[model samples]
Target: MTNEELEFNNDEEVLTLYDNEGNEVLYRKLLQFYHPEFKKEYLILAEESNFSDEDGDIELIPMISTDDEEGQLLPVETDEEWDMIEEIVNTQMDEPEE
Candidate 1:
């Protein structure tokens, strides 16, 4: 789906993606934050019906970029980067939202 087609409900954002079998699946944006060191925005998403942390707060991180003609989502690489991102997310979640 195109960036302009993104839909938001309440405070969560929705993105449509295709599975290996090319079936459409919906994912919800849980959190979005910029990495100071990387200077890139990242999205934390959870798959449909898998939104709770009851089992575990499983999330996907995709680097967000608009420099391309269309928006781009890239996978996060390196354990160090993932660790930093997680730390940032945790820190932000602990604070009150304005």
Candidate 2:
């Protein structure tokens, strides 16, 4: 991967992760997954609460995608399955109103 390909920038609230091939594997899926030990660390940082200002680089373990190797796409035949996934994604994207 080149310098630009491995670069991860978080200008806004969105976090974009790119693969070696310059394909976006994951995007804006809550930075909480970056470190499992500390829950809602990103939220705390965003709120500027009692959060550590230390900018530590977190490395993610490589995940083997079955579809990537086999070139197989997810079977989304029925509308129900699509709706279910859509609902789940929507729920994740929703922010709690204060």
Candidate 3:
């Protein structure tokens, strides 16, 4: 991907992703950042709904870069990748909101 494409400076709040059965799922964008270690841009998102876990926690989805346009969302493929992404999420959760 080009440097410009990697910017991911999108302003859209909701993103629609299709499931394997061709169902559409809407997600709210939480954050997006470039991973220098993996040389990839990652998009972190949460489902756009009032639903939560039994403990009232919203699940975060981590998406990796794709060869095509930015609308496409690809999941993290490896254990190492998941670890890195999880670390980022943990750090974000540990931060104090202003």
TM-score of each: 0.67, 0.26, 0.73
Question: Which pairs clash in model 2?
Answer: none
Report the backbone clash tally of model 1: 0
Question: Which pairs clash in model 1?
Answer: none
Q: Which 10-residue span in candidate 2 carries the lowest summed lDDT?
A: 38-47
Taking the tens digit of each residue's C-alpha lDDT, what string does model 2 give over 43-63? 101222212246643232212
lDDT of 1 by residue, 11-95 (tens): 5778887777999988888777555566676777778667666977666544554357656677788787788766766665666
Query: What's each prediction's clash count?
Result: 0, 0, 0
What's the CA error at residue 13 for candidate 1, in Å?
A: 1.0
What is the overall TM-score of model 1 with all chains considered together? Answer: 0.67
Model-by-model lDDT, in order? Answer: 0.65, 0.31, 0.73
**Could you tell me how far off, in angstroms, the CA of residue 98 lies in candidate 1 after the best superposition?**
4.8
